[model samples]
Target: MAGSNFVSEIFLFPLSGKIAPILAMATEIKAEPAMVLAGVLLSLVAIYIASKAGGEFFNWLGFPPVLGELVGGVVIGISALNLVIFPENGVDSSASIIVKMLELTAGLAPDAAEVTFQAQSEVLEVLAEIGVIILLFEIGLESNIKDLMQVGVQSLVVATVGVTLPFVAGTAGMMGIFHVSAVPAIFAGAALTATSIGITSRVLTEINRLNTKEGQIILGAAVIDDVMGIIILAVVASLAKTGEVDIINAVYLIVSASVFLVGAVLLGRFFNDTFIFFAEKFKTRGRAVIPALTIALFMSYVGAAIHLEAILGAFAAGLVLDNLHETEVGRELEKLILPISDVLVPIFFVTVGAKTNLGVLNPAVPANREGLVIAIFLIVVAIVGKVACGFSVFGLGNVNRLAIGVGMVPRGEVGLVFAAVGSASGALSPALDVAIILMVIITTFLAPPLLRVVFGEGEPEAEEVPETSG
Candidate 1:
């Protein structure tokens, strides 16, 4: 679950100071409420600018707009221009252009700079979390629950194979080849098991394949992958703390996640009617979307409460409401959500890019040299491990197996979550952590273009409209 909790857990360090101090006043200027608000506004300016510029540039280059947003984030983030940065170990808050701007214009004292930056960054982090939840909810809305059901078995196989192969291969190789300790090796392997549903789904939607058999299979598998990933995360985190796994906690997570997802979907039939009932009676503006958004948020909350990713609940909520496609409310819901999605979704991708610290890639650092080598090995495993999932399909004739495999390639934020958790727990060495980050970055950027190739870059065929009854 890439919830707010995870966001807080990951950014333990402050941003590196980029701009020199301009004020040395004896009286420390406290960061007032207005000062914090100013900082947040500045950060939003940087975020939207990065999102638009990157998205536009990438679209022109014949790539996914999401890819460009990520690049834009990297360009402005700690990796490049330092316009937006997060709290990280051994970094200066002064490095944030947002912070600097606030200091100069808002009279933010040097002493309160870090606090203001932290507060501003936290807001971004929460927004990013919400962005992803909205992304998943949007995906769920687009998907057909019945179609997903049809491919459930194949998806389960693909997800199982995807998780097992990467976990086993990565863990064994780390221990056997690099002589890494068992716990860290397991943690790294767990990181490799993640397949970013958001990144892959966005690409599929871009190519107009989200409803295709191959697309449905990939979407179903990615959801399964998330459930499995959470279970794996729980296990590894426990191992990190105590040199052994906690079987009971692992079992509990597995059971709760399964029940939550199944329960949400089964109850969606009930929800569909309830949603329409409330929507029709409201007659006010936002009637359809407001009720729908309420469901998404509630489902997300339920998922989070159950120790699963809140996105799961949101996705499930979307699936529950899938039947609404036949109704006027359903059609209105989609139209309304798109505008909101346009604004929030980019924030998630950009923040993922910004949070990525590229300093680990520099070979000039003696410690990074070994990590680079490890990173190469991990990257290969990460790609090959998920790519192999395409072959796991059964009973489906003429399925685009390679596309399925390639679709699973990008690790995106999910992989980052694993890396962050492992690093925080002291289960990963610096080199190993760097290697995982690189693996995530490469696979994430690599998969979208590869998907475009495998699926063919021609104009997508017009979609078949779902049958509707008055």
Candidate 2:
């Protein structure tokens, strides 16, 4: 009887221990999923409000909306504010709910903590990237291709010179000042090659110069510059990934991109004609709405598939359809996309702020000295390199050479894209990353007012200047 009772107690003890673990897991499972959903929704709403508030603040300051958006993001992301929080292992109600739901539905419990974190990060990153792509696309949709073509030659010269000087200067500066490797130096140069068209356009429009020859040329060249910048970025990214710059692969990328660009243009032309013909034939109610959106999506998809920036596809689509006379489709499309652009684009810029860790600027860190010096040198190179591009317009007929140079100044979204990519690829140090972010903000903020002063306010239409002497 005594032996039997001892055996029974031992069995009961084992059962009790197992039950406790099960209860603990059940508690965790109940809490985590709700937390994740709530976090995402809250973050997004907070971002939107911040973006809107930022725009209003910047507008009052006589700056572009982007300036406010960026500042707002930075403010929120600063460690002092503690506004943006990431989840950790603490049994906080919010995080616990998310973990619990994930565990119950997907069997991803405590062991899957890292996986869940990574997935959330990825979703945020992708959303930001898509915002950028769509912003560029909207720009394309609004541009007038016919007017753009008339200004093409001078714009081409400006863009080429603008891109080239920066590329060379930035590369040289990185190599000489930082003593970094050729690959990193080249990447740095590539990052500086991007011109922020949105900022330039806004300044031009504000000055009432949007319809002028110089304005048109600046706009056109900015678009071309974006295309060239993307190609360079792709090549560099490929090199970074493989460590071997395969000429064949590079050429393939170039060819594929070119083909997609050309194909988009041709397809857009064909579709425009077909749509006009069908609209006349069938007297359709929606007219070009369905067709235009369809074309936009198709061109965007094609560009993505070819490893080209979807913005290029959007630009191409715009160029083709911009000539559609007497159609409400163009105007309608613009209206539809404006809200999306306003919302998503700010998110992209804000994400830039979130990723930036200004603590790197602390003088307490020894590495910051290197970052500061490099940043100052790069900023000088960035400014002077593009300023030199004005010389390309020296012989051109009555062009505001200084204005053209200023138009090329702001690195804008393009610079941000480069910095983001570098950070993601682990190609940039933390300090270097922070420096690049500052470069984007400074250049963007300074360009508009400077250009306004140089070009004169209130649109007295500048004449088209030839690229060379007649």
Candidate 3:
């Protein structure tokens, strides 16, 4: 009878666990048909609350709301708001449950557990990549080509200095101290090449510098920096995968990226002209704006096909549309894209936090300890490296050197993306992965307060533009 009871209990496990958790946790679940619906609902509420809280926090700190959004995600993932909980059993809980359900229903095993786990992980990874692609598309829609161009030369110099110094410092520090492999050290250095423009943009805006010459220069430089970083990532990925760094292929990628930039500009000019001509002639109600979005998506697709980052393509598309005669159309596209970003972007950040395992820092794990030491060395390199770039701001007379340095500090989405890719690629050990994530968080979190101190202010008031009409 006891044996029979034990079997019965085993049989009852699924039903009890399911219903009990629905009542008790009221948060955790598989992304099933019903749970997906719940996730959507929860995501909306989470975004709204996060946005508001993020805004207030940034306002207080004189930084951008994006920093707040990112911090808010970190807080939620680390806190007990219980909105998007991981599987109760473990990382593989969802897969395990599904397999058990299948066993109970079919009374026979179909495949190895390892195979099923691999398949599920692959699917999750693909979904995450798609989320990132869409994010790049949204970023493209927000970019303004005219603004980028006006700030281009100075920004390029700033970005170049910013990228080079960090890469050298990070690589040297990792290779010399950690005695890590050259390839991994290069990857580590590559990871440091990213600058979080969102944070810098916010800081400049807060300090009433966004429209200033320096602010525009910073924004332009950041956009260029992002493009350069993507190209480097593609090259590194190729090198890692093939174990051979082809000089010709690397040069081809750089040349191809440059060609694309030029082509995008010319194409954008032609499209804007054609779009304006048609819109003026047809005067169609809502049909006027769809073309811009269609073009943006198409360009993004082309960018991916050409071995370039999709965000670069999207930014190109935005630049092409910028200074177009279709201001109304641009505004409409912005409105549409903003809501989509609010929903999807948070998923990316939340997933990022969820993947970060802080326990990797425990000294009990020898490898983890090695990673922690490497992380400390890398962080110091990362800080000192960018600080060194402040001296490279040439031609701008009496510029606030401290502000430039502070602006270069935040690593933002670019750094996280690099770390995520490294982690996914198996190039970064778990501990090293956590360290990179921590670095990204620290750099982003420190920007606002650092900027406030350097620039002096509680949100600098906007300066008046002199009247142009005579």
Please report the candidate that would top lDDT against the real structure. Answer: 1
How do all models score by TM-score?
0.92, 0.76, 0.73
Candidate 2: give its CA RMSD in angstroms: 12.9
Q: Write the per-residue lDDT of candidate 2 for residues 1-470, one digit (tens) a residue.
A: 43233323322333353344435655444335544464455567767777888878877877666667766776665433434433221122234333344456656556644444433444555577667666656555555656665566777888898888888988887888678887777878888888977667656755666556667777777877877886677667655655655455456556776677566665666767776676455555555555665666677777765556666666677666765645665555556666666666777777666545566566687878777777777787788877677667644476677777778889976787787667656677766766776677678767876777777645444353323322
Instruction: Output the better candidate (2/3) by TM-score.
Output: 2
Instruction: In angstroms, give how far residue 321 of model 1 lies from its true place.
Output: 0.6
TM-score of 3: 0.73
Best by TM-score: 1
Clashes of 3: 0
Query: For model 1, how does the per-residue alpha-carbon lDDT over 1-470 read when each residue is reduced to its tens digit?
Result: 33333323322221212111212211345446787788878877888999999999988999988889989889878898887788752466778888888778878887888767766676788899899899999999999887888889999999999999999999999999999988999998999999999999998998788988889999999999999998888778877877777677777778888899889888988998888888899977999988888989998998887778899999998999988887999999999999999999988999888887789899999889999999999999998988898998999776788999999999999998888778878778888888998999999999998998898866344432233343
What is the Cα-based lDDT of residue 365 in candidate 3?
Answer: 77
